[model samples]
Target: MVMAFRKKPTSVIRTKASKPKTPTNWLHLIKPMLMFLCLLFAYVMYSNWSSWLALLDKTPIRAYALTHKTQFTTNSDIRDLLSKEPVLKGYFGQDIQEIKDKFLEIPWIKDVAVRKVYPDRISLTLVEHRPTAIWNQTRFVSAQGVVFDLPKERFNADGLPELYGPDSEAKKVLEAWYKIQKDLESRNLVLKSVAMDIRGSWTITLNNHVELRLGRGDWLPKIDRFVTIFPEIEIPDGKRLSYVDLRYEHGAAVGFISQ
Candidate 1:
C-alpha cells in the first residue's frame, strides 16, 4: 500500500515604514567641530607657555627672599637690593627668582633657598660663608676654595698651615701640612711653614727657621727613621745646622749656611 503527505498553511503579517533620505551633509558639521577643537588646543598651549615665561622672568627676585624663619630679620633690605636695578625689575614681574640671583651675587652669601609661599609673599633663606684663611695678603679663601673680599677682622684659624705655591697644589699641600702638624703636635714639635717645590719635594720649617727636608721618595719612612735617630747625638759647640735632610736610606744629612 502507498502512503501520501499533505502541506500545512502559513499566516503573513505587514508593517508600514517609509521615509525618503534627507540629503545628509554630516562632513560639514564634523569639519567645523574638528577645526574648533584644534584652535582651542593651540590657544591653551600658548597661554600655558606665556604664563611659564612670565614666571621665569620673576624667578630671580622671588629666589632672593628670606624663608619664613626668625622674625629678627626682614625682607626690606632684600627688596631694596632688588629694586635698585631697573633692568632686573623689568625682567621679573611678581617673580622672586631674579631677586634671589641678585642676593646671591652678594659676596657674603654662601647659599640661598627660595620658596613660593602662596597668596602674597615669598620666603628666602640665606647661608653666609665663614672665612677660613687669609689668601696671599689681599683675599680670603673659604674652606671650599671660594675666594672673596678680605674680612675686616683677621680670622684666627686653629692649626691651619700656611699655603704657598700654585693653586693646583692647594689641596694636596693643605692635607699634608695638616697631617704633619697633628703629628708634630703629638711629639711636642711646633710646625711652621710646609713648603713644597715645583718638583714636589717637601720641606718643613719650625721655630727659629729650622728646616727639615723630606726628599722625593717615601717621606713617612724617612721621617720615622729621623725621629728615631734625632735624640741620640749632640752637635759640636757653635755649629748649629740649618736643615736636616732625610732623603738618604743609609743615614741623614745636614745643611748649614755659612755667613
Candidate 2:
C-alpha cells in the first residue's frame, strides 16, 4: 500500500510511517567506523609504506548500536541491500556520496548521511520515514507530500482515508480530502471513503450509507451547498436518503429510496 510522510523536516520525509524497527541496519551503524579505519590505513600506507603493513588486523569497525521505532523494514531487507556494496576498502577512503547513494536504493530508506572522523573513522546516519495516509488504495503519502509504496500488512491502515486519484495528482487529491473532511465534521458526518476518478471528478461515501456525487472540478463549494441544504431535506415518510447529486450550477437534486 502507499504511504505519506508526517511531521518530518523538508529534508527527511515519511513512514506510519511504516518505519524500520530493528536489526542488520545497525551494521550500517558500524559501516562508517570500518570505512574510517580502512581509509586511515590507506592514508598511512601512502605516507610511509612501513606502518601500513604492521597494523592491518585492527579493523576500526566495533560493535553496533541499533535504534528504530517501527518494524516495517526488516534485518534481511538491510542485509541484502548492503551485501551488494562494493567492498568498502576497494577505493581509498571510498567516495562518501557513493556509499550514501548505494543504501538510498532501499524503497523504505529516505536519506543517508556520511562523514569522516578525526582518528580515521567513517560515520553513517540513516533517516527514517513517517507515513500519514494511504493513497490510490495502495501507497502512502508523507506529511511533506512524498509518495511511496509499502506492503499492506506492514502498517496500520485502520483510520487513514483511502484516497483514489491519478498518480500525478496525489498531493492535490490528498489536500482536497482534508478540506472535505473538515466540512464533513461540521455536519457531524462520518466519512467512509473519498475517490477522485481519472477525469478528476469526486465522490464520497458517508457512514449513513449515503453517497455524495460532488461532480468534477473542486468539490468544496458543492459540499458547502450540501451542508446548507441537508438538514432541510424531508424524508416524506417510509423513505431514506440514498444520494445527493451536487453537480448543479445552483441547488442540488436529492434522491431517496424506500426504507
Candidate 3:
C-alpha cells in the first residue's frame, strides 16, 4: 500500500517581486524636512524683527547725527547712548554699504569701510589717494596714473619734469625722454630738450644747442659710440658745431656753423 500511494502533489505558488525604489520617488521624503526648516526660519525672523523694532523705538536720533559743525560733546553723547546695555540700536542711520559708497565718492577718498558695533556705534576706516605728479596744468596724477585735481596750495612738485605733448603721445614721450636723460647723465651731460618729429623721430638738444638726431633703431649703442668720439673732435675756430648726426652706421657727421 505504501508503494502504491503517491505523495500528494505540493501546492505551487509564485509571488511577484517587490519593485526597486528609485531616487526620483524618494524625493517626496524631503518635503516634510523642508517644511520644518521653513517654519523654523520664520520663527527666527519674527523673533529678531521684534527685538530690533523694540531696540530701535528706544534709540535717540538727535544724538547720532553726523554733522561737521557739531562739537565733540555731541559725539560723546552718541557714544554714551550706544554703550548702554542690551545693545541699543538705530544709531547707524544709514546702511553701511550706502555710507561706504558715499565716502568713496569724496575726491581724496580711495576706499572706505563701515562696521556696526554691538550696540549702536559704527567704526569707519578710510584710504586716501597719494598725489604723485601734476597732470597737464591742473589735475594731479597718482603713482598709478589716476588723475585728480586739488588746489595748487594743497600740493607741491618742484622738481618733477613738466611734460607737454599730445594726449596720445605724452606718456610715451615722457617715458622715452626720461630714459634718454638717464643715459645722458652717464656722460656728465644734461639734455635740454627731447622733441619728437612729426614722424615720431627723436631729436635731442644738448645744453649748448648741439642737436643730435637719433633715428628709430635702438639709440643706446650709437649714443655710446658717439660719446667715445665726441671729446676727440675739434671744432674749427669761429665755427661752432650746430648738429651731430649719429644715424649713420659707421661714423657721425657734424654740421658746422658758417663763420
Candidate 4:
C-alpha cells in the first residue's frame, strides 16, 4: 500500500519596523558658545578703547624716580635729561619706547629698566657703560668695543688713550689698541694712542711721545720685537726716542725728531 504524509502549515515570520533617522542640525554647533564669547569680547574692547585711553590720560605722570649704577649718570642728570621727553605727556598713551630710546642715546647708558609708579610717577633704572677709550677724539668706546657719542663736550682727555680709525673699523682699532697696550705695559712702557690710517696701516704712540709704525699687516710680532729691544737699546744721551718704523722685513729703523 502507498502512504503520503500531509505538510504542516509554514510558520509566519515577524519583525518590528525601524524608525527613520533625522538629519544632523549643524547650526547646533554653538552648544559650548565659545565663538560667541570671543565675538562679545572683541565688541567690548572695540567700543571701550577710546574710553580706556581717556582714563589713562587723566592719570598723568607727575614725577620721576631714577636709579642707576653709574658714575656719569647722576639722579639729577637723568632728571634734567629726560624732563624734556614726552614720557610725562600721558600716563600710558605717551611713548615709553621713545623715552627708552632717548635714554639709550646717552653714550654712557648701557641698559635701562622702566616701570610706572602707580599714581603719578615714572621710574627708571639704568646701567652705564664702562669707557675704555676715546674714539677719533669725539666719541667714547665701551669696554665691549662699542662706540657712541657723548651729549656734552669732553674737552679733557681724562687720560684715556685716543683711538683713530674709520667709523666702520672702530672695533678693530680698539682691539688692536688693547693688545698693543697690554704688551707695552708689560715692559713698563705706556701706550698713549693707537691709530689706523685710511690705508689700513697701523701706528701706535708711546707715552714717551715716540710713534711705532706697524704698517699694513699683523703687528703683534713687531710689537714684541720692539718691546724686547726697548729697555737695553742705547740712545745718545741728548737725543730722545722719536719713532721706530717696523715696516721692513729684516729689522726696524729708528728715527729721531728733527733738531
Best-matching candidate per lDDT: 4
- What digit string (tens of lDDT, one per residue) describes model 4 on residues 132-197? 788888788877878876654533548987999887888888888878878777778889999998
Ranking by TM-score: 4, 2, 1, 3
For each candidate, give its TM-score against the true structure: 0.58, 0.62, 0.45, 0.70
Relative to the true structure, how large is the alpha-carbon lDDT of every model?
A: 0.64, 0.72, 0.63, 0.78
lDDT for position 127 in model 4: 82
Backbone clashes, candidate 3:
0
Question: C-alpha displacement of 40 in model 2, angstroms?
Answer: 25
> Candidate 2 residues 183-205, lDDT tens each?
88987888877778888788898
Error of 3 at 81 (Å): 24
Report the number of clashing residue pairs per model: 21, 28, 0, 0
Give the number of the best model, judged by TM-score: 4
TM-score of 3: 0.45
Better of 1 and 2 by TM-score: 2
TM for candidate 2 is 0.62
State in Å the error of residue 20, model 2: 88
RMSD of every candidate to native, in Å, equals 7.4, 30.3, 11.8, 7.1
Which residue runs does candidate 1 get wrong by more than 4 Å? 1-19, 23-109, 117-121, 132-159, 225-259
Model 3 per-residue lDDT tens digits across residues 127-208:
5666654456565555554555555665576655444334456556567767988999988887766655556777777877
Q: Which stretches of candidate 2 lie over 4 Å from their true place?
A: 1-71, 116-122, 228-242, 251-259
Model 4 lDDT at residue 61: 66
